[model samples]
Target: MGLIVLRPTRATCVSLACFVVTILCLVSNGPCRAQLSSTFYDKKCSTALGTIQTAVRTAVSSERRMAASLMRVHFHDCFVQGCDASVLLDDTSSSPGEKSAFQNLGSLRGFEVIDSVKSKVEDVCPGVVSCADLLAVVARDASVAVGGPTWTVKLGRRDSMSASQSLAESNLPRATDDLDDLISLFRSKGLNSKEMVALSGSHTIGQAQCITFRPRIYNETNIDDGFASTRRRRCSFTDGDSNLAPLDLVTPNSFDSNYFKNLIQKKGLLTTDQALFNGGSTDDFVTEYSEDRSAFYRDFALAMIKMGDIDPLTGSSGQAQLSSTFYDKTCPRALSTIRADVRRAISREHRMAASLMRLHFHDCFVQGCDASVLLDDTSSSPGEKSAFQNLGSLRGFEVIDSVKSRVQEVCPGVVSCADILAVAARDASVAVGGPTWTVKLGRRDSTSASQSLAESNLPGATDDLNDLISLFRSKGLNSKEMVALSGSHTIGQAQCVTFRQRIYNETNIDAGFARTRKRRCPFNNGDSNLAALDLVTPNSFDNNYFKNLIQKKGLLTTDQVLFNGGSTDGFVTEYSKDRSAFYRDFALAMIKMGDIDPLTGSSGQIRRNCRVAN
Candidate 1:
């Protein structure tokens, strides 16, 4: 007879079945990358990334390196669709990180600096560059603008010719997600549920804005008082609409595993984040990540590589540029050799993408995102990069630095930094063979990336699938992809503010989840504004979240919808039935979501760089 493995059902009922056999095994050997350690990258790419990090450090007063790092984090998040650099852009226009202008600023504010640098580079070099290389350089430079740490970067990438708003919407994850959906999203990107949990560990470093967690604190009254009080001081929710959170709270100024501990308690900032431990087959992995901070870091590095592995430039075909602008837009007849070189470079770019896709699958399946391969001393110090007390360990110019290095080597005086930043993101997504998106070139770079832009571009911590779907739709993503990406929440932490809403407003939610939420998220009578999102399993990464809904214990109304009602019920059930199956679907979906409208032969020139399309 075939063996039958029992799937954990109820968040409370699931015996620590511990299906996750300690995911940290990814780090058992050491740096997972090709022996590339943080030290190595710093030494190799620092020159290119230096300026960006400097800009990041300079951008903020209290936490320079942290701010810089934050920019890098944001950039990484936003690149799959367009390298508008919205990730680095925060809601700086407002202290609360939530303002009308924050979301409305558009692409203009986020990537202005890169444009300026590109224009300057153009004067010195011209068309001899590619956008990908420019992005590498500017990412580092942008980090510097915000007061961030410095790192080394390599260049030699090309640009895309178009941009797609659709892929961004469908591919990105929502703030409120469950284990099943989260796993699905990673699977789409060639990732698995365990890795999803590991990557969620990033919350250990950033801070959730008050707006994002207000729902958890104000709506759900049953919560750890101390946890709610500490976060409540960040904002006010009189209007009943606030969505924000600091990516990290424990070592808010640095990047570390404190977020895992936050999950252990009900202190996570987003309802989606808190869902990790709601009860399910994946919880063991969360425990493992929490137990070993080093393991989390190692995995995180590997996951980053996987994320970066997307669409890369391959051999001889992807003719990389020194900057966004390649030298001589009109090719000379005698330049056949150089043109052939460009063609070969472009082909290489495609090959690189295929390679990245393969790596992504490995990262996703082998051990999830604990991309131990990326770990080699990649850790940064707050003092050297950005201060952790305020900003966290994020840096700037994450990719631009690499682009600049590549462009400068070949063309010298022909590329623009602006295009590099833009193109690199496109190529990166493509490298992972993520969804193909359209990228338009000729974008002028600015000297700054706004905090407001970053806040606006990203989804809020409290957003449900609908809210997330809306955000993604605006970016041109499909409902299917929207549903798929929501799964990222399965692993991350949710701030109390974001989770409070569902717990308190019983009248607003679907009945099934509303009844159980009272127990999981309690709202006090006197101070309805003070509450929390989850009572149990706030940090364990598993599918118990679905089981919670089965029992009406879902903290957020949106979460309950995964099982009890709405279009997501089937998906939730399927995910619960078999974790591996969910992982497969999620990986494919991610690939589609990432490809919004990829450029093809003559769709545009094989960009000399990624930031700018040819």
Candidate 2:
């Protein structure tokens, strides 16, 4: 499906505000409903609601059956494990998911529609909206697509990391369940008989497979004779098990009270559907809904609201909703403050730009951009700063301290050291000639640091091709990203100790380049001597690093391996020829690298000092 861009009008905003107020008032009676808010994303991602609505409308317009399919997907998600989005997970070798259960294997549909909406939202705002909340809003938009009632969807639900096929098999209602069985299943999910009857009305708009209704029509006595004859013509005893038939014969594709009306005429397609009105406890409610269409719409909307509120992960339970506008309201001048300080530091020393950027990369690789690298070495804990890779080599600690001090002057305790390091990295890139990207905020600083992990996780300069690829892969980056991110070396400098063996013994290096490097860095002396990583335009961030590799002028063993007739040689050639392609991929890789195992929400705290935890 294609993305539909929508801008909200003034009247639409007013109407949505009024509806949000009404929903808040209605849900205020209970404590469970207070965990979510109707306006949770009003400031975080303003275009999220409109984007989801447009995407759902486009999908349903392409195929009218997708409306009911979307609604059913939401229902199935909420029923199993309390709307945590466990149903959307695909079954892996280690984790068997809900989608492969006997109840949902071939019955579930509209997964691609949800996936499309997620991609569109991530384009506008990444790491902000959860899949669980997306399902809730998609169900509302799908209802309005096909003459169904709409309700305000309370947000702030988080996605589950695990899925349970056993829970799906036991918790979901079956096609052949009687009235007592249906009531008990709904009751297990905290829904009453009235709400169960209201939710059952969703079958009016979707078609059912013949396997689900064959026994109900052929052997059941409660079904209408004419309806049974019509159904039996398509579904035989042994064949045509997957043949399709509508649940409501009157209006199959409209979300009306026709499903309830069909029950009164003994035309409910599934055995569990006809059991509602076959001299059961739900017969009176079914009769009332068939007579009053407005009543069915009202109860259905209310039931949907209740179902969406089932056991959601709210507050500090799940991952924090990171947004680009996270500090807009709290500290309006946060980005500018960081940008100004970073530029001043770069002006004093051009190499400081590369230093600050390297600090971010090292901090993220070790402990997920938590500023653990900035922590001073204490007697009790060695911290990452004293690790073998960063003992006396890493610089720009005072620059980060200066930036954090200035940020604290504007908004104390609201800004995180982790977020400050991330923004500083972006600003340092832009200070020189580098591509800029939006930095997702809301990461918290780690209270503790690990010396052992830092020693193990950080990549070494002498690493071979396979070792380099494996190190980057451990942090969720591919070989292409590894090559693109290595472009940061286009502006930095490597010490003599890091690359001495490459120039002295390696045959891949150019003879002239090795002779020039040996003049500054001898074979065994001047281990602390510095040499530019890129021989041409060492201060600018460009694709010259890749170009140098093509000429066999790479300064480090890891650098030369990227173009040493390996799997990454094509990427090196492509980047050497195209500067814009390198910049774009580098920026995307930076953003992806910043998201590695972040300490978000309440998992970590905002440090008062960059050197010490609060």
Candidate 3:
């Protein structure tokens, strides 16, 4: 006996059990060197395709009807603003986005599914995978999940920074369109009549709302009488406008030539669906597709490939300069060598993990992770190493030097000191059992250091909540990101001088915790004595720092201020309860911080020694 698996349907598929067949009909013939490639992210983010596939399959398996909605999202996104993910943006005060456009408001679904896939991809390769490429891949995976023909997805598409509601309203095809209208719309997008007929076969799976097909059932003479009556049972003149019915009456969840078959029998649900066979120029193509499913699949694949080629951004266009695989070919062992060194260093001294992580944070806060913090003081100008905030507190220079020396041995002058710092910070986090995020490479070392920027930008241990928030804000971070990044204190320590006044003078602190801390950090003496930032688990990276904040056990004034009934207090409480949430947000925040103004693309030279310029 065969096992049966029950798959849930999306609430949007209620009663309708059908899917919409919107066409991505753009095309460019002759194939004169495609801008996008199937192997675009092969080295940059190897797991990106697999991650998208898993997320799409999981979503479709949970809600069998979501396959069509996911595919429709890609069509809608591509038609408006050239498949740059403009449809995915929510409306803001400055610009009304495509989500609220007439065709997409309530008709479109499966946005949450795309959001879930993006989050999963971001986890493995943060700042590496573009949302535009994710939509394209998700569309393909959704088709395969429902026993549909698969196609190669050309990647390296970058997401748009803005969306357009007017463009969506003008560009998207309407269900009320007739044969000429549909053909003209496809023609405007560069698709011919035959490609239009093939692409419309996507109606084989998905549901359509009553509002879309009501006029066809009530007034259209080309539609079948029995089909109209069946549709009219649920769709009235004005009521049940949101109710749904399948586009393909026979197999709504499977992809095949059933839509073409329905068109031939005059049972097409939408006016546009019936227009194909109402003695129009596209009638012969529709008849051909209905008879041969293999022919339908072949043309559909070709049409989709053409649609995906519409105005895609590739190479250096509309993308950030940094990439995760910057050294994949030049220095294949760069990341591995750095990771191994970080692990050995952490194993020898666990505190080294926190030091390395903090080193990256401090470097980015000042001059944007350009390795300026590693520079020794020169005769001409002092470096960030001599800044007041980093003077005697900063550590891990030797660890960075050791890693740089080892990397130089294998691929001399190929890996930059700045890129090594970013990778090492991620490796250190994993070594200490914290979250790991991908680090975008291609950052070059700064020729000079700015002690003044380091002193002003880096947050102080004695800073108040407002001061901390403002400092982070200047570095392109919000209060929530500030709170998440501060969670890094879960594994580090503060010197006596930094927290002495907080232990002795602060009233919000726990008395017992203060007394224990004061034992090693005496007043006016032992200024260099250290106390664990997270007293419970000082050597492990977790959410205990937020827990300590809740109990007034935070070692630094800045740490306690995060949970002191301020704007960020809620974040502290939430992290204290959910460690996973804290880790996820922390990893994202780290990637954002790593993007703060950096030297890349011929702006700076790669240094042989991390402590000085080449």
Best by TM-score: 2
RMSD list, candidates in order? 21.8, 18.9, 20.9
- Predicted structure with the largest lDDT when compared to the true one: 2
Question: What lDDT does the true structure give each of the candidates?
Answer: 0.41, 0.80, 0.79
Q: C-alpha displacement of 296 in model 1, angstroms?
A: 1.8
Please count the clashing residue pairs in each candidate, in the order shown: 239, 0, 5
Runs off by more than 4 Å, candidate 2:
1-88, 91-159, 162-316
lDDT of 1 by residue, 1-614 (tens): 00001111111111223222111101112111112222432433344334443443444444433443344443344334322222322333222111112322231133444444444444544443333444544544443343222344444332332222233434555555556556545554445566677667655544444545677776764356787776666666674244344655556655556667777676767766777766677767777877886677667555544444333221122111122223347222212332233334435443332222222222222212112111112133111112111123122232334545455566553443433333443344333323333333332222112232223334444555655444445344455544444443343233334456665654545465455444534554322222223334332223444445556665555555555566666766666666555545555555433322222111123323323322
Rank ordering of all candidates by lDDT, starting from the highest? 2, 3, 1
**Residue 396 of candidate 1: its Cα lDDT?**
22
Clashes of 1: 239
Candidate 2 residue-wise lDDT, 1-614, digit = tens? 00001111111110122111101101111112326888998998889999999999999999988998999888988876466666787787876778888888888889889888988887887767777788899999999999999999999776555566755775677777677667755654557889999999998898888888888888899888999999888899889988888777788878899999899999999988888899989999999999999999999999999999775544432234467898999999999999999999999999999999999998988746678888888899898988888988899999989998999999999888889888988999998999999998977777777676677668777777766665565465778999999999999798999999999999998999999999989987999999999989899999999999999999999899999999999999999999999999999998888875555555567888999877
> Lowest summed lDDT over 10 consecutive residues: which window, candidate 1?
1-10
